[model samples]
Target: MSRYQQASHVFWRCQYHIVWTPKYRFRILKDNVGKEVWRCIQVYSAQLGCEVVELNVQIDHVHLVIKVPPKISISKLMGALKGKIALKLFSKFPHLRKNKMWGNRFWQRGYFVDSVGINEDIIRRYVRHQEKMERQEQAELALD
Candidate 1:
């Protein structure tokens, strides 16, 4: 499981690996643009009460691993994030807004999100050692 966070009545761990590409897969994110996008995501996630565990901005797409609260729906979060980030980029980097082909849109409408739940190490240990644990218990029972 992911690192759980607790409130007075809520103890939860909900994380996701999200991937989104630019419109028509244009390789526009580079240098300042990429850095700015990364910063925007980080700052915005924090502002929205989410924790950005990892962010990778590629030329055409971005990969973000984030810890989000159970209360927020993924669709709503993405819609807000994509819209705000696009507006910020268009304003700060006017050249990006000038792209006629892209018009005013920056990101693709559809995005990919996978639940990053249940760590690999724990699964591996359980799969490899469950029989051993059962055997140890059986031995102890026989002694008693």
Candidate 2:
């Protein structure tokens, strides 16, 4: 076999930065709830064969930097993550089942995704900063 043929079979590292918010942007993930939500995200990501490189659960949204196999479609991966987390969260915390949280859906229809190319460090820092940003926003809102 040619060297070129052997090189073609190599797998490239793929990193995906994803961000999504709750339906209607509800601030349901407060205090300890955020930890639970993060746990659910971790569990779901593991089930989907994705490595959770960085993750932050804010009051209204979440930021996740994951490394997924090339075989998975972005939509399918997102759906699986959202679905599994939603089921686990709602089942664990019945209050989240209220219409305010989401009657039938856990996440909003749209999500932000970016390929972390050479800026993986920047994206990781951004994901980690999500919680701090959320806290600052809450503090600002409280001052009003």
Candidate 3:
């Protein structure tokens, strides 16, 4: 049971199971590289206000369970996470670019995203509340 996030009229617990892989599914995420990947995920996720509930960096692919806010789009969230991790990973381990990758591309294009939990009604209610709060905030700001 994850803690629910509350803001004005909104209350949510948005969690997702995300999976992705390196270019060509290479078994390069080992030893230091694996450790670095985990670190990057935590650091980058924190910067984006997302909580990583669980993470596993296998040799070829990575699995992550993350909780994000309702206002953030899945595409934007994934893009930021993958982009920052790749940038940092490449910079820290330049040797990876020698032959494993090309043109600074580390992780492959596109990823898998699945909303966690089985309570669709709960998520729906939270989304509705979040929208209502946003509208109210905008109205209040407009009055000033």
lDDT values for all models: 0.82, 0.81, 0.81
Q: Compare the candidates by lDDT and give the number of the best one.
A: 1
Candidate 3 deviant stretches above 4 angstroms: 119-144
Once fitted onto the true fold, the runs of candidate 2 whose alpha carbons sit more than 4 angstroms away are 1-9, 134-144
- Which of the two, 1 or 2, has more TM-score? 2
Q: List the lowest-lDDT window of 10 residues for candidate 3.
A: 122-131
Displacement of residue 62 (Cα, Å) in model 3 is 0.6
- TM-score against truth, every candidate: 0.79, 0.82, 0.77
Instruction: Say which candidate scores most in TM-score.
Output: 2
The reply for model 1, stretches above 4 Å from the true place, is 119-144
What's the true lDDT of residue 98 in model 2?
70
Cα lDDT tens digits for candidate 3, 15-108: 8878898989988899999999989899988888888777777778887878898888889988998888888888898888787445678888
lDDT of 1 by residue, 92-128 (tens): 9998887898778999989998887766344334434
Q: Model 3 scores what on Cα lDDT?
A: 0.81
lDDT per residue for candidate 2 within 51-81, as digits (tens), equals 8999888788888998877778889998888
Sort all candidates by TM-score, best to worst: 2, 1, 3
